[model samples]
Target: MNVDLDTAKEGLAVLQQYGGQAAAAAGSLLAGLASPFQLFEGGWGLNLLFFGVLGLLAYSLVVLAPRQ
Candidate 1:
């Protein structure tokens, strides 16, 4: 196998770019979740409402599923 330095460098650049993008996305997600007080103050009750709905749906599924 003929390995070239330029190809390796290009691969590393591509990897760095992907890592940067992933890091940015993760940072945004963390920032969004970190300020719960601000979120709730800013009319984020819908988040909790959605969670409540999800819990009810899960409970209903468990109750309605056939037991072995």
Candidate 2:
């Protein structure tokens, strides 16, 4: 296949721009998810509560998953 240099460069630019946007979106999503964990830093009680809740959520998901 014959491809023009300018056309390839334009395609690469578009891909790079899309990748950057995707990275930014992923970063924001992770930051939002992690924001709640910051509360656990206040004390050991909060840390234990956070882990307990997380464990319960994990267990529920496991119990509720579909069986083949």
Candidate 3:
């Protein structure tokens, strides 16, 4: 009975450690995904700038592409 209790406690400790790591990983992933939209959170000027930069980048890619 004592051995069984020790084994169960060890198992629970390992599970808790893994669970904490998983939660931290999930939070970091969410923050990374949300970072791109943070530029738009600054309102109209930032939004315009973001779109303008994106457009310029796209135009550059098209203009600089090699002919097939």
> Which runs of model 3 end up more than 4 angstroms from their true locations?
1-3, 40-68
**18-64 in candidate 1: lDDT tens per residue?**
99999999999987886663434556587678668888999878986
Q: How much RMSD separates candidate 3 from the native structure?
A: 6.5
Instruction: Pull out the clashing pairs in model 3.
Output: none
Indicate the residue-level lDDT of 61 in model 3: 83
Q: Between the candidate structures 1 and 2, which one is better when assessed by TM-score? A: 2
lDDT of 1: 0.80
Give the residue spans of candidate 1 off by over 4 A.
38-68
The prediction achieving the highest lDDT against the true structure is 2
Candidate 3's residue-wise lDDT over 1-68, tens digit each?
A: 35688889999999999999999999999989867766766566787788899999988788766543
Query: Stretches of candidate 2 above 4 Å error?
Result: 40-68
Q: Tens-digit lDDT track for model 2 on 17-57?
A: 99999999999999898777766566668877878999999
RMSD over all Cα atoms, model 2? 8.1
lDDT of each: 0.80, 0.85, 0.84
Residue 49 in model 3: lDDT: 86
| Candidate of highest TM-score | 2
Residue 43 of candidate 1: its Cα lDDT? 64
Q: State the lDDT at 34 in candidate 2.
A: 71
